[model samples]
Target: MPWGERPRWARWVSVIWIVGFVEGTGAHLLDLISGGLHAYHAWPLPSQVLFHALLVVDLLVAVLVARGLPSGPPLGAAVMVTDLTANYQGNWSGLLHEPLAYVGVTGLLPMTLFGLFVVGTALPLGRAFRGIVRPV
Candidate 1:
């Protein structure tokens, strides 16, 4: 209720982002744990760094959004943008040239969908969080 009226959509957006980040955390954790810290060694060093950073940013955004912090929307948007870039960079060949071939490729579809969701909801979320106060 701290979000006042017109918060229904905000709540839905927050939950969607939380769920996405939680899943991202789990996935990145498994990837690192299974392949060690250098799991993405095949990628360029910067790309590898980006992949590693995903774990932290994903978790951070989730916490920020859950707590009704004002930074959630923008930060979430940035995370998704960066994540989508990384994914696209690695998969652009198949994605651009053979789009249908990537219909069910691992985490690609979900990440893209969630990224689009974050982008579409960013403006509304920004307006909503402009005056949000953490509920006691």
Candidate 2:
């Protein structure tokens, strides 16, 4: 099938990814714009830059994935994992000293799981949606 023609489920997944990318990017941008560098003073300069850069890269990958690029999802997943790690470190309040602090941050876990799901299924999902495999 042509790149424009993809299965409905695949399209839905792509839309979900795009929405996540927008939300994630928007949140970061809002913080930077509204609160400025002081908002991220909790993290080091390099860490802040790295996290934002990764977000931009993830957004680009999301666009490619939405356009049916076969490699996009796995790459996005890797980016998401790295982003998650950065978030964890930035928010770290002594995991060993206060294990409950980790649980206080709920968003990271679900997002990580979703990213893993995308990575695990990317190839088969891409093939299935492109009509390379029959729908089961």
Q: What is each predicted model's overall lDDT from 0 to 1? A: 0.81, 0.69
Residue pairs clashing, model 1 = none
> How accurate locally is residue 65 in candidate 2, as Cα lDDT from 0 to 100?
76
TM-score of each: 0.86, 0.71
Query: Which of the numbered candidates is closest to the native, going by highest TM-score?
Result: 1
Compared to the true structure, candidate 2 yields what TM-score?
0.71
User: For candidate 2, lDDT tens digit of each residue in 1-136?
Assistant: 3345777767777777777766676767777787776666778787788666754776787677767776677777777777777777766667567766456334666566667766666776667545686646
Residue clash pairs of candidate 2? none
> Which lDDT tens digits does candidate 1 get at residues 1-136?
2444437778888888889888888888888999988899877788889888888888998888888777888898998898889888987877889888777746688788889999888767767777643442
Indicate the worst ten consecutive residues by lDDT in candidate 1.
Answer: 1-10
